[model samples]
Target: MARPKDDDPDMFRIIVATDIHLGYMEKDPARGNDSLVSFEEILEIASKNNADFVLLGGDLFHENKPSRRTLHGCMALLRKYCMGDKPIQYEFLSDQSVNFDHCQFPTLNYDDPNLNISMPVLSIHGNHDDPTGQGNLCSLDILHTAGLVNYFGKTSNLEKIQLSPLLFQKGTTKVCLYGLGSVRDERLHRMFVHKNVTMLRPKENQEDWFNMFVVHQNRSKHSATNYIPEQFLDDFLDLIIWGHEHECRIDPEWNGIQNFYVSQPGSSVATSLSEGETVKKHIGLLQIKGKDFMMKKIPLETVRPFYMEDIVLGETSLNPDDHNVLKKVEAFCTEKVETLLDKAAMEHTGNRKQPTKALIRLRIDYTGFEPFSIHRFGQKFVDRVANPKDLVLFHRRKAGVKKEESGADNELLAKIRPQSLDSARVEDMVRDYFGQVEETSKLQLLTEKGMGDAVKEYVDKEEREAISELVKYQLQKTQDHLKVRNASEDRIDKEVTHYREERKKRKEEDEEVAEALKRAHSMRSQSEDHPCDDDRMSLDSDEESRTTRGRGRGRGSRSRGAKETTRGRGSRGGRGSRGGRGQMKEPVIATNGNRSILDAFASSSSSASQRSARGGNKRKTYSGMDMSDDDDVVTIDDEDPFDISSSSRKQKSQRKTTSRRGVAFDSDSDDDIIPLPKRRR
Candidate 1:
């Protein structure tokens, strides 16, 4: 294949990487700065290559709530390398309001007149740095707010995802970059299967553009519904930049069924000491000219080399019954460690600077022998390896046991089949437990998936109030539903009582489930065929087939190359909107409830003519943005708990000046007093 010419004016050059995992083990002594150093190198690479922009797939930060030090390091790097006065060659043609709807400043950093940005950095959030909490903010949101990075692909409405690509044009070559930040795999899978995902195409000349999709989902199938199948993606896409999986498969692999090439740049830093991390890490320098593209894999030299190997002692001549068995095993392990150290030394022979230390993991299978002290063994190489504490792992194979004999073993076997090593998701475990129970006995108000999501949030993000908040939210929703149904006071009370009882019962059952899972984890099999699996869901072929066919049919039925425009924008709105720059629409603000904050502010200033024009009941438009119904308008008294004003005494006094859901005229000033909605009971 002929490569794109270096000085081609039409070519769009982009530096692509993913899963930088900044702040991963930042507290560690040996590998604390590994992620940051590699990330800096990526930026330097982009600068030296004179790339148009840097596109990160996801997982830019290892933690959803990264430490201040991590945030400072990331911000400093971006400021140092990305901010400049270099002229951007590409023309951004996408609607900024729709692409960066989550942000207050919808425009890209480079486009903003207040900031002087040269090398633009565009990124989505991965599972590690996905949004959480009441505000639904992520680490990238901070970077975006600071005008250091252009954050896109955030969908507040998970029920229906409308992917509006960021369209860019350089000379005659047009590129459409579509991004979807990390979504819960199962929910996203179901959405795709049900054909709820929509990819909004340009109004005209769509075939002339090279389309690229950047998604941070499970590319590798973990379970039936835990992964997004490549076939589910639109066939129009030219390239797919996959993230989340840490293996560095930077070479673009052709997906014949989907007719798109997938390039997984993988994690810049090794987050784990697994065998997959041993692959040479690289970031791709992608050049797109018209519809043709070429990917050049650029090696990352700052990454700490990780070497992993497994040895089966039983398969060797070593016998457990031998009197010198312990000494012999120790000698064998020492020899393996020395060999890995030599290999690590050999890896740094090139002009690249040597890393702090190499990471090594040796898995020993002492099937019929007693395990030795791993801590003592690791002390010998304390200065040699980054992870000395977990240098060696001892495994003992499980014997053929009957299901009836061991409850723990039976549960483990039932949950994890021999053919697959992927662990069941928290949601799956919750569903299985509920499925086994009688339908009448199962909790009615709280759903298994909802509880599962809450549990996962609590466990993974350390959000202490996740479970309590879910319980409260569910109860409130139930009460609202019953009230809407016009249930009697007695009936409502009875329903509430039943719900509480069921919740209590469910809590007790959850404890029992937790204990069983703990036991299963302890007695997990370590056989080569069924090694311990990570916290990922399993895959299903049935769901994949359903997703492929349903999505394919759905796409075929939609208008080809038709633009999806928001109301009041223009006749030819959305990405193709040629409306004057001065006519920029106000961003549609989303509140906690299905209410519009702007509607509340707009209601205070509505004139008699405006009211008459709205027919007193129709939805209103504010600054070319459609507002929600009056009933869904957020008012002062109904202040969001996450809002700073919720705890302010001055704000409370201001709200008390107006009546509930009533407008009052101020005698002192010309302004009309806006009534506040009553607080929820």
Candidate 2:
């Protein structure tokens, strides 16, 4: 509702300046004492134009309660130019355009004479000022001092005021102004109490006139789902000065209808606003001509912003050096310290004892640096630098810390506030919290030595289920491969067992063959008379038997000698001519394939060598040597009990040439194939 008796819109010239952010840390010591200097400049601009009243939309201080000296400087400036105390306020005024006699700043927040002078300054709170209904903090305290500001909207409680159906009245035009601002401690102006934050919600009974609604928040033109829907005031707003936006925009379309003007006056001081949130720094002046109101924008020049730099620490340079990265960093820190010190020195020059303009703040950000140097620098800079606005050390230093892991075994101990996972930083933060928590721990367990009730326990909630799932999957996928491996191992065991059995059978056959050959050789070597002395001589029993048999069967004894030569060679080799008298048996050994195949090759090979040796010149002792029985093995092959190729003559002949040996092949009659065996000494 708009009250017609309030103030006329057409008769008065209105200037809206907003978002001053006066105690801004970035602009301090550079912008003519403080950021409030821009406010004084605006007042001078208002006086030349003979404005009626000035409306400051919000955020007058970077801090809720400015520092005492910066606060006094602001009051002193407004008293001089904004009230009756200025040289231009009365000097160029033939028609005392504004009355400026009453003013107050000391204790009370009541109205003063300066409210009537120059253009009265009216203000509403923004987030930075966070106006509490209690005596915690307010812009009213500062505004009351110079008598330049009026109407401390009932901000003591987070409550909204209703207009009386009529606002300021002109000769025919009446302008209704509706004000809404942030309540105390609500984050970003959300969650205001229902009792203090709503106007006449009965939409049909909402007052009609030139309505001006001022609020300190994001423009409600974004999608309706993100922010609180009740905060949107789209009901018949003629001129809406959306105060919280820090960018200068006069978009008529942003209000969702024609003839709806939403004006954002940006900032009264040129300070860096939120770049990430996309709000620019600007101030707004409203110039009304007839039925139409025109707007002009003034940009507050920003002082140099806070410089942020990242220097990487390397393995080679992690240890601090004189001219290396550490030295450059030191020089940078020293320059920043000097810059802040110089700033403080330049303020309120030629003072009685202290400064009138007063200095406020300096901030430096240190990120991505090693902790050892940062700690040393933080201590040294604080001790050495003079007269700073406010010094904040943000980097991680061992700030009254406690060690997390206490032993050489590298065990991790839990701390209160974990660091940023950056080396030493998170540890440092944890250390700080640990010390605090440890103090609390001691107090809580003062009577006992136990850890008491303060320790937070560790539990692995996911381990059992995760292990079960993993094992189940593995069994499902790999069972077939496991079976294949078992089968391969079984085959290898069978092959090894077969080889050992074959080797034993071959060893027994070799012993019988050797024994038979020994008896046969003795029969061929001795005479029949030698057996007459068998009981009295050096002759072996088998040899005596063989010698007696030789006299009985001469051909049989000789054939036995040939068999001896065959067996005595490597495997079944015929003995080579002992004195070059006859063909000899050759040597043979197993390479691979069947054992029978090797025996056949050996038997055949021996036959070939015997033929060659019989053809040679040495044939003298052949008359007496009884190698006949040994020679009969070829006849045995033709009638052998074994059906294998080993005991067959045709197969033995087929194996005439073998890769098993380089023995040359030769053919001989069965008798000529094996040579006569000689007697051993």
Task: Candidate 2: list runs displaced more than 4 Å.
Answer: 1-12, 24-32, 84-116, 130-142, 156-166, 171-173, 184-208, 218-231, 244-253, 257-259, 270-280, 289-291, 301-681
- On TM-score, the candidate that comes out on top is 1
lDDT of each: 0.73, 0.41
Model 1: per-residue Cα lDDT at residue 635:
16
Model 1, 1-681: lDDT tens digits are 248888799998999999999999999988888899899999999999999999999999998899999999999999999988899998999889999989978889998898988899999999989986546688999899999999999998867899999999999999999999998787788889889999999989979989999999987777787799999999999999999888888999999998889998988988776777888999999998988889999998878888989999988888899998998898889999999999898778353644857889999988887778899999999999988899998987777864565878778868852222223466667778888999687767776766776677667676655666567666675787677768787687567656656655554334332333333333332222353222111111111111222111112211244322112222212343332211122222333222233432344443334344434533233322343332112112223547676546434533542222232232222132232444554
Worst-scoring 10-residue span by lDDT in model 1: 535-544
Candidate 1 runs further than 4 Å off: 349-353, 401-449, 472-681
555, model 1: CA deviation in Å? 87
Give the alpha carbon lDDT tens digit for every residue of 406-425 in model 2. 56435433322221210122
Residue 189, model 1, lDDT: 88
